[model samples]
Target: MVLIVLGFIIFIAINVVVKNNPVAAKFAGAGRILALVFILLGISTACVKQIDAGEIGVKSLFGSIQNDIMGSGLHFINPLLDVKKLDVKTQNYTMSGVNDEGNKAGDDAIKVLTSDGLEVTIDLTVLYRVVGADAPRLLRETGEDYRDKIVRPITRTKIRDNAVYYQAVDLFGSKRDEFQQRIYKSIEDDF
Candidate 1:
């Protein structure tokens, strides 16, 4: 803003001087040009943003979302509609529980079933992280509820789908590994 004011002053001074001294006015004109250039460059620079590493930004122009994603480093943006950043980084989760066995559980849960059809409660802990790059779409589509809707449903589906394929014996015996792998595959597909 100051630069804009200075540029206007220089331009007026140049025009005034031009009325009497032509040579001095020519030098003043140069100053005016430089000042105006400075003002424009300053405005443009002010509109730019510098996103840090591991950050992603969604840019919108006049309420229209831009398809291109902005990432780490400096970028020039329009003052009218600019960047909104979202951090994308690996995170950690921890869970613990106590079992009837009188032992501290190592973040694991167990769901059981009987010969008759019934829902069994299982104690389990999951330490998971996002290992993909579809976070923007994920967030946009599900907002903050992505975990509950996408993650938990997929997890439950995986468990149900795999569990149905085997009898109760398989869940606790040698077939457990196969059941777990199947569950993992199912979850992966959903994810």
Candidate 2:
């Protein structure tokens, strides 16, 4: 509506200028082009995605997240907002104690006993999906460097700190699964 009104006004101005001064009317065309760009950008930002079956969408307006979650099918929204698609599908990650070399990492799989008697090693795979509303926040806080900023330090800290509480056998032995869970939780919370 706003664009339509502005467009109509610009059209009238262009006609009046064309009738009076063709050169001035030509200059006004440049302003119309700029206005057209703004309108297109606004429309693009207000994009709507038809949610897939069993999926939900998160939306943000001018970077402020909206709580109105989107479910399947057509939805209406302001063009000044952004839409993010999120899969609500069930997913799982299969983990086994293994290193980069493909060998079964020992009980201390992720942690090795240091010369000073500290044991530590960390090997794990993660499965993750972004929360729709928080995607913009996540992007702003970490940008494209999220993995490094959020993942590595939390992981290293958890493994090292947890190792201090357990011996090499506990780190690498039957208790390995427990350790893995602890590390996963730590990183998940911190990240």
Candidate 3:
């Protein structure tokens, strides 16, 4: 955009200013050429988008999100459109009791109350990925930082919601797999 603006300024100056100055009049054509170069360069840069492997692009124009997406490759698009690249590969998120082991600082483990009225600390690791076809809707509704706005909160809530179905000791021992499976189903449905 700046380049295009600068190019227009130079073009106007050459036509209006150079015509009056006989000494610099010889360079009028050269100035117009330079301006054209800048404009073309600006247009090319803005129209071409390159998406890397395992990534998708969501486009928005004038603050309105577009439904159609851009796959991994070069795409020619509107110069005014804004493109946000998102990774589509499997992503890992952890909420652990140990510092520096989770996505956030400090102990980010989930605390859930069991049916027996016991408080349990859970270190959770979730593996997930963005659906390429749903990237546009995801961006439109949740913006780019969906992990903080959607994933983390929803995951913790589902875990806590299902934890009450079992006793605290069972969650860590005999019924651990059942507890995990229940939460997994809950989270999957929500997502």
Candidate 4:
């Protein structure tokens, strides 16, 4: 938009200058060419969008979201529309003491009280991805920061809720898988 305005300004200035001075006529032609270049460049750039591999593009016009989910590669879209890229690859959200590849390590491990009234710190690593087909719905419902807005809060809440159903010793030792499965089910239901 700025480019188009700048081009229009240059064209107006050139027209004014050429009428006053014949010597400036040659420079006016060059100025007109430069303005055309700016306008063309802006239009061409605005007409296309690129979605990276393992990502989905969500389109929006003004503030209203469109339902179409664009796959990886170059896509021709409305110049005025906005495209938001969302990573669809599996991401690891970790609550751990050490940082590792593919893991979003953080100090905020989940703490929950067991049936026995004992408190336990649960170090969890959740691997999840947004379904490409559901990308539009995800954007409409949760916006762009769905990981922070939906995933993290829901995962933490479900884990803490399920933890109270089991004994602390069972959660720490023998029945770990069962507890994990319950947490998984709870989180999956939300999606």
Residue 102, candidate 1: alpha-carbon lDDT: 18
Per-residue C-alpha lDDT of model 1 across residues 60-148, encoded as one tens digit per residue: 67555566777789888776665666666653221224544312335334454534455454443333454335545655566545556
TM-score order, best first, reads: 3, 4, 1, 2
Estimate, for each residue in 29-147, the C-alpha lDDT of model 4 and write its tens digit: 79999989988887888888999999999899987888888999999888999998999999877765454532464456778899999999888888899998888888888898887
Clashes of each: 5, 10, 0, 0
What is the per-residue lDDT of model 3 for residues 42-118, given as tens digits with 9 covering 90 to 100?
A: 88889999999999998999989899999999999999999999999999899999999999999999999999999
For candidate 3, the lDDT comes to 0.93
TM-score of each: 0.51, 0.49, 0.90, 0.87
Off by over 4 Å in 1: 1-52, 61-64, 80-87, 90-120, 123-133
Q: How close is candidate 4 to the true structure, as a TM-score?
A: 0.87
Give the runs in model 4 whose Cα sits over 4 Å from its true position.
1-6, 12-23, 97-106
How big is the positional error of residue 159 in model 1, measured in Å on the Cα after superposition?
1.5
For each of the candidates, the C-alpha root-mean-square deviation to the true structure, in angstroms, is 9.4, 7.8, 1.9, 2.6
Could you give me the TM-score of model 2 versus the true structure?
0.49
Give the poorly placed runs of model 2, Cα more than 4 Å off: 1-47, 53-55, 86-119, 129-152, 184-191
Of models 1 and 4, which has the larger TM-score? 4
- Judging by lDDT against the true structure, name the best candidate: 3
